[model samples]
Structures are given as C-alpha cells and as structure tokens.
Target: MTKNCFLKESKSFFTLIAVFFSCCLFAQQDDLQSETENEFWRNVQFGGGIGLGFGSGYTDISLAPSAIYNFNKYVAFGVGAQYKYLKQKDYYASHLYGGSLIGLLNPINQIQLSAELEQLRVNVNLDGSNSNSQDYWNTGLFIGAGYRSGNATIGARYNVLNDKNNIYGSAFMPFFRMYF
Candidate 1:
C-alpha cells in the first residue's frame, strides 16, 4: 500500500478508538449521577459533638460538626470539622482546627464500630518573660466502639498516636454523638 494511504488508515483507527472510550466514560458518569440523585437525601445524617472544661487556671472548649452517608444498614462514611481552644494561665494557650474522615459499622443492634483520621493545625502561644508562639500540623487516628440508643451514641476511643504534646491530648477519649 502507498505510505500516504497507510498513514491515513492509522489516523482513522486511532480516532475511532478515542471516540469509543470517550463515549464509555461519559456513559459511566451519567449512571453514577443518576444513582446519586435517587435517594441521596435519605442516606444523609448531620450532627456532631461539643466539649467544655473549666479549672482554676485552665479552660478547654471544643466544637465538632459532622455529616454522614449511610451506605447500608451496616456501613457508613462521614466527614467532620473540629475546633478547640485551650488556655492555661501563666503557661500557654492554643487553638486547634482540623477535619476528619470517619467510618462506622453496625454488627448488631445497639453496637457500633468506629474509626477516624484527623488532620489539624495547632497554634500555640507561650506567656513568659520572653513570649514565643508557633504553628504546626497534627494528625491522629482513633479506633473504638459505641453504644447507640435512638439518635445518640456514647463511645470511648483510643488515639494511636496520642501524646502529651499531641493536640488531641489523651490516649483515651470519650465521645458523645447525635444524628439527625
């Protein structure tokens, strides 16, 4: 065959393949959008937690808001935002802001298994003769279980990377959650 004819046929073959794949991609995307629009509202839940503490020379406060999508009776995926303020007189004060990815499983009635990963920015200020401040990112992973009653869940989690200097504080933390 002539060189020009061979090149023309090759170009046509490549163009056909490209068009086929593009159509397939768009078809898959449309199916996904249709499913998402079907019962999206029924699977959505919104709620979170609030924490407060007081002491002679220290105070702690936190607010966390979360939303979840239940995939089935046994599985859920969620996201949340966290904000915390800590102050210690004559010592230091800090602000924590972060977000988290959460997962849950219900193996039986009233029982839930939970896990979460959080990434936070911690800003610290020291009060002293020579004051200093700094900012950094902290990440934490927690795993635990909870008891669910109606719209409330009470649980205790252990942070795998918890340390005194970690913005999340203790290794063992109790949590309260509500869903609407």
Candidate 2:
C-alpha cells in the first residue's frame, strides 16, 4: 500500500532496459534476404511514446518504451515501463515510475483491441520540497480499441481502476501506438 520508493534506483533500472532495447532497434537490418530468418526475432517489435507539454509554469514529460511479441497475426503480449514527471511552478511535483503488462488482439487487420494492467510507484513533493512528501502505489487497468494499419494504431482507452491521483489524469486517455 505505502512504502519508500526510490526514484533514483528505478531510474537506473529503466535506463538499463532502454539501452538494451535501443541495441535491438539498431540491430534490425533492412535486408532480410541476406540474413538468417529467425522466427522469434522476426515477430518481435520495439516502439513507444514520448510526451512533453508546458504552459504557464506547468510541465509534463513522459517516456514509455515497450516491446511486444506477436504470436501470430491476431495476438500479442508485452511489457512496458513508464515514467512521468509533472511540475507546476509553485504547487507540487510528482514522479511516477513503474511497469505494465499488455495484451493485444486483432480480429481483423483494421481493428485492434487491448487490455493493459499498470502498477506504478508514485512520489510527490509539495511546494518544491526536496524530501519525499508522498509515496504510494497506483494501479490502473485499461481496456481499449483502436484503428489499426500497417504498423500503427490510434485509439483511446478507459481505466477501469481510475481512482484518486489517477495516473493519466482522466478515466479516458488517447494513445498512439507504433511498432517497428
């Protein structure tokens, strides 16, 4: 329910994952004919989202990189890490870092449906205090649908577990997913 969650330590862990995935992304070669066809690697995809917004001394920045394994044309499962920082000049500052499990289904090439469960460690300091003023775990389970194309999906999801200090700020959030 509540505990000391170190932002520094988790930052290191996420950094390591980011490096490993970056390598995988760069290792991809365009000429498949010249290389061995590894079915496992072929069905894997790497991509994520970055968000930044600032206005009138308020700032929000987020990074979420994920990898998914597609079992076939119809099913997929994956994990992702998320980190978001929110700051309002003289109000409060928050750090949210954690991981999620996601499952995807495509009944047809044009439609995608998904279910995602996220567990996050939240830390907030009020009035710019350097100490951790609040620490807690927040959970969200989102069910969504989107329009799917070659490598992208645009959709909105509703968090069934939406509660106090909701992670995405709303019960409904829009998402853009791309895998390459």
Candidate 3:
C-alpha cells in the first residue's frame, strides 16, 4: 500500500481504539461507584431549560431536558436533548435539534468542573420570492468550571471548536444548572 494510505488507515485505527478505551474506562469507574449508600434513583437528577418569546419583529422557542446520575461524590455523567426555533420578521427562520453527553466533577462543596460533547443539526430558510434553505451539522466540545451552591450552579464555558458559522454563535457561553 502507499505510504499515505497506510498513514490514513493508522489514524483511523488509533481513533477507534481511543474511543473504545474511553468507554471502557467510564464504565469501569461507574461500576466501581455502585457501592455507594444512596439508591440508584436517589442519585439521579432531572432538569433542563425552557424559553419562549415573541415580539413585533421576531419569535423564539426553546426546550432542553436532561438527566444526570451522580456515580459518586467526585464523578457524574448525564445526557441531554435540545430543540430551538427562531424567526425574524420578513427575513428567515431556523430550527435546531441536538443531544449531548455530559461529564462533571466536584472536588469540594463549592467548586465544580464540567465537560460536554454535543452534536446538533440545524436547518434555516430565507423568506421571499427567491428563498433558499440549508441544513448542516455542528459538533462542539465545551469545558467549564463553576461555583456551586446548594442545588444550583452557575458557570461559563468555552467551546473549543466554536466558529463564526457554528450554531453555538459564540465560543464563550454561560450556563445555569439545578439538581432536584
């Protein structure tokens, strides 16, 4: 085989191996935490975000729902889904849907660290006689730190892959979380 072909194949092989090992590591760590005193459901939290807005010039709607499992005091994992729609008067409309894999760590009572991997699909259409439509996918990896108080957390995160054309809009974003 050509040298270029061999190199390409090796990269793909290494990526698959890395992903496999990561999955195995997370699974083993979670299993090791099963001995905690709390019941399975007791360690689970459910919450998300909601938004609805309308004006003379625009409309907006959003919904996000998530569930998290606190495997132990230091590690947690979760998943979430999101949907949003926006429209501007006599201009365009957009629809977006996505899901995320979340990981969190709390080393103390007041500080938390988080990571999220998200995959989203977005569709947009212009209005008027010469209208056009486009659909695309966006993936983002965000890392953040936050202050925690009781059941609420507030933080800022930066998306490592954010770009001017990405659905996330900004490389920097703020977040609020609550555990029930």
Candidate 4:
C-alpha cells in the first residue's frame, strides 16, 4: 500500500512540472510572435519636398532617393541622395546635390524618430559674367519625428547648417516620403 502511494505521488509531481513547463513555452511563443509583428525591412524609398529658404529668397524643391536596411524593429540606417532646385528672385537659380545618412529610431511602428546628416554642394551662375560660376559645399544635420503607415510616410525636420555664404540659416523642413 505504501509503495502504491509513493508511485502515485511521484507521478503527480512530474505531471505538475510538465504542466508548468508547457505554460512557459506558450508564453515564450507569444512573445516571439509579438516581436515578429513589429519588424521593418530594407527597401527603396522615393520622396519629394518643398521648403522656403531662410536667406536665399526662394522656394526649393527636393527629390530624394534612399535605401534603408533595418537591423531590427527599433533601429535602421540608410543612405541616399537628393537633388534640389531653388529659384531666387533676381539671383541666379541654384542647383544642389546632396548625399545623406538617415537613422530611424523606431522602424516598426507608426511613430518614429529620425535623424539625418547631409553633405551638400550648391552651384550658381555668376552675375554679369557669361562663363563664370560659383560653387559652395556645406554640411547639414537634421532631426525630427515621423509617422509611417503602409508605404507612406510624413515627417518634419529641423535643419542646421553652416551658413557661411549667408545662404540659409536654421529652418524647418516638412517632407513626404514613400517606400516600396
């Protein structure tokens, strides 16, 4: 009779342990599912923007092409190039070529943080000279928040650059972005 009791109790203890372990496994699976639901991927992006120049007295239009790779759900890095045209009244039209690095702080959700660094080259025709031109190169940094839904994204950035040629000071730039 004692042997029977001992065997029964041992079986019950093992059954309890098995139940506990199974519950833990289920919880871990749920956590993994949540994580997979929130991941971003690397892909191509194309966007355009319009902004007012702080000192150049013009409205600028920019075309940007970017490629991004997400390390996880919350972080990504990208590189891209931009072409900008600025029309200033009574001054030479300026063309800008820039390369940029972008960082996405939250790559998975609708709301995210973004930061960018750009190296820009500006070219303008010289006044009263038929064959003369002026060029300038500068660096810019921008930071802001963004919202992404499906393939569409919208964001606003504050830009800071060295205005050595008195071209542009600190300014606010709002942009629209699309990815595929």
Q: Where in model 3 is the C-alpha error above 4 Å?
A: 1-38, 129-131
The candidate 4 region of ten consecutive residues with least summed lDDT is 39-48
Q: Candidate 2's residue-wise lDDT over 4-38, tens digit each?
A: 36676677889999999888766765335335457
Model 2 poorest ten-residue lDDT run: 28-37
Candidate 3 matches the true fold with a TM-score of 0.75
Best by TM-score: 2
Residue 64 local lDDT, model 2: 96
Off by over 4 Å in 1: 1-38, 129-131
Order of all candidates by TM-score, from best down to worst? 2, 3, 1, 4
Global lDDT of each model? 0.90, 0.90, 0.90, 0.74
Among all windows of 10 consecutive residues in model 1, the one with the lowest summed lDDT is: 126-135
The RMSD of every model to the true structure, in order and in angstroms, is: 9.5, 21.6, 18.5, 10.5
Model 1: per-residue Cα lDDT over 1-180, one tens digit each: 999999999999999999999999999999889887878978999999888999999999999999999999889999999999999999999999999999989898699889999999998989873447878999899998899987788999989988777865478989887889
Q: What local lDDT score does residue 113 receive in model 3, on the 0 to 100 scale?
A: 96
Question: RMSD (Cα, Å) of candidate 1?
Answer: 9.5
Residue pairs with backbone overlap in model 3: none
Error of 4 at 92 (Å): 0.5
